[model samples]
Target: PADGRPIVELRGAGKSYGNVRALHGVDLQVFPSQVTCVLGDNGAGKSTLIKIISGLHQHSEGEFLVDGRPVRFTTPRQALDRGIATVYQDLATVPLMPVWRNFFLGSEMTRGPWPVRRLDIERMKKTADEELRAMGIILDDLEQPIGTLSGGQRQCVAIARAVYFGARVLILDEPTAALGVKQSGVVLKYIAAARDRGLGVIFITHNPHHAYMVGDHFSVLRLGTLELSAARSEIGLEELTNHMAGGAELAALKHELATVRGVDVEELPEEEDLTAPVPASSEGTS
Candidate 1:
């Protein structure tokens, strides 16, 4: 069942590096079993926001809350200890390792007499397989290197691993940025699966289309500041895309393009089809 309350919240959060400000008074809330999508262009402070939420960097200002209780973390481990897990674009998996090994990369299982501890490979493999299947991921070669799987498959494994490890909040950075249409669909499905299982999912991506597909809440960032934040019911896809592209900026761009190309701006293609695809380079990190 969905947890109706927010698991994490940031009020007036800010960060800086030397003289340059990376984030400015950003406020966000992540509810359990709901997908909160953060959309922004390059240099929009998206990375800085992720770092702050995932505990890689402390905000210089504002309140950080966990379950409405004020809290602060000096390190990523501290956040993870609170059941917050960050799955970055690279995903933090070793491609050459087997699926099971990657599933339990940092937290491997061990069982034996105290003096002769040994990895419980069989048990780990069985658990990994079952968990992946439960997430609707079907992989025939559990023993194969994780690199053999597609981008979406690797992401599913990473997400399933986080759930298996008892993560209550999962932060994903562009989980589907580097896949074909079909592959991106697969990743989106798994994201929904994770949300359905009651995890607060903070999904950071530049692609509004992907965000709209899985997000229940939307936050747009531009020039190191939050542009808009609202529930899904409050806005439609066109509004979301316009906001993400700098609503006014996009309008100007459209006019400029039409003028330069000698076409009627109003006669341009349907706004519905103008939604851009996820960038190829936006693929998750390994």
Candidate 2:
């Protein structure tokens, strides 16, 4: 990235619950105009890391820094106050609310003061429409219920809202997990749009293909540990997909399944060394 300073940085960041550690010594950097992708299968500490970064959970072990300041956050609002906005997978929206209403739900613009104040509906509608267009998204209408829009559109609306609210770092959790191939592409397009607008984006997903399409940095986790981390120039999509899928492990599993099917396991392809970027964490790192 052209920007030398990272908007968000994690130094040996880890989280633990009771005796079980969900993350261990994870180092990451999020720079403006770049998408830092965190790829991992289920239970790979992605959720735990997201919680810590979003202020839903504090790191039990290491450092979380925002804008060169070393600080701990106790709530999501604190993270938001620092210009780090998160768009969750379940979405923060009311199904029956109009697109504009959902766009400005918790942070609605108001007119007048005290008892005389009311929602500035028209201004919000105009702003929402404009912001979406600014991000290269054009909606037919803002009066339609948000639920009436496709999943891709709703996710795009949430992303547009985050960008409009002055978010400097955007953390998106599985934005394309529920969508089909086409809809996933739609979300990816907006993600690129956000990056082009100069926001540091943290995109969390298990799909390497989707991540590769727009990511500038990649990190893969497995069993709550950071298994791989590298710049886009240092890694390719196939290597990333292999890491997330456990390249050698998957091959071994295939061997076992082949035996049950009465097929010769010896014919299975041999696992090759996929090593390139070093693992971000190792045993007892934290």
Candidate 3:
């Protein structure tokens, strides 16, 4: 955690289940005050990589390091103790629980002496509100069921909770996958806010637009191996999308599928063509 050292780094890290290889030769770097976006499609080994980083699974090959020191975590708690936290896509909140309750779910503060410990209701609620507000979140009531809040608000709550718990490195799994455009934008803003607060973030998502908006570095995965790695300045959003889609291979497959199916591969309409009428044959087909 000293100056110029990456907070988390994976060197040729890999995972396997018996003869089934889930990942291979993966290299990832996450530094303080930066967002490292991991882009991959379904079955591209993104899940496996996250598991290794979160200490849910150990790498079968190569090394996993934290703060430039090699470490092999046997459990997620060990990782958490070392200041690495993963916020999974599900958001991990009980729908019926109040927002403040969800925020302090497992790690609630206790009052009074030992053995007779009781939940410090007022303090926990006040701290939760303060933490959320610090992240630019404003809720009408912390006592409302977490399910009553929007998806973006819930995600922000989870993020603020992690940061408040002293997480030096935060790993987010597809944080924007289920939200609408406006809601997704809201979550993205907090992601940038988290980075601004000097936390190293590992953002895992298939959506390039969301990743590009906040990522300072990118690592693209394909079939359990790293295919590309670059800083934000070295790549464009279009190129990132192409890589995730397998670039020319995906294009070739699309053409081949179209040819084999005897369907014309029509070009997508331009932005200016929104008001134009579709051709009679193509109408209602697309």
Candidate 4:
């Protein structure tokens, strides 16, 4: 199933609103069975790029391609029709709704005549259980409200649902942002599982550790521009982390901080406890 062709691509992509340019000449290629990690800090044109891919906004310049052909999607539904599915941070499930109900919310199974249609509750519940189990998710009860599930569990459910509905491309936005250590690990496992199942996954996040764990390709964005792109083999965790923190810029800031505090870099204490109270300010002292 891995033909090595990109499922989607953006060449020289740019987006602008009024006189403000949010993105500039960004290029990305997403292939099946691979995870493409997009890393950027706040105001780094991340949201704008996501909008362009998910059809929430159109690019003002450059070519958007699906299966190596140029196309412009007028709406998110249009992209969805082409098997591009985006799983937002919020997960999009009704918290108060039962797991099975939320699983089939918009695309519910039905039985009986058209005018007298009724939900096929038994079938829906059984299918939801099977689908989730196939994704290695074992829920205590399918009848339980989705609100009762943990954040990682909810994210897994959303992923399983997207795959079940025939999504070939999965766009995940900050899937592990608010999760604890253990919960984040759980979600990362599922993300790898999704990629292994032959889905082209675009993982958007600022966490280098999380991205480095499962990424096959990396794209770093900064200040409305594409700063770097590399295959997994060309980069390491430390290098990726430094680039995200603005490499040289971070070093410059550290030097400035030490200078202002009148501390010789080589003579300073090796360990400064961040939890300790700040020393008194010497603003007016000689």
Q: Can you give the TM-score per candidate against the true fold?
A: 0.88, 0.91, 0.90, 0.89
Model 1 C-alpha lDDT per residue in residues 1-286, reported as the tens digit of each score: 2545689999999898999998998999998888999999999989998898788998988888998898878899989888998988887888899999999998889998998899999999999999999998889989999999988888889999999988999999988788888888888888899999999999999888888888899999998899999998998776787777664665667777875756667765454445544556334321
**Which should have the higher TM-score, number 1 or number 3?**
3
**CA lDDT of 267 in candidate 4?**
49
Report the poorest 10 consecutive residues by lDDT, candidate 1. 277-286
Worst 10 residues of 3 by lDDT: 277-286
Candidate 1 regions off by >4 Å? 1-4, 250-286
- Report the candidate with higher TM-score, 2 versus 4: 2
The root-mean-square deviation over C-alpha atoms between each candidate and the true structure, in angstroms, is 4.9, 6.2, 6.6, 8.4
Candidate 2 has an lDDT of 0.89
For candidate 1, the lDDT comes to 0.86
Which candidate model has the greater lDDT, 2 or 3?
Answer: 2
Residue-wise C-alpha lDDT for candidate 2, range 1-286, written one tens digit per residue? 6658899999999998999999999999999999999999889999998999899999988889888889799999999999999999999899998999999998999999898999898999999999999998899989999999999999999999999999999999999999987788889989999999999999999988788888899999888888999998998766887787686785878767886967776765556744334333211200
Top-down TM-score ranking: 2, 3, 4, 1
lDDT, model 4 = 0.87
Q: Over 4 Å off in model 4, which ranges? A: 251-286
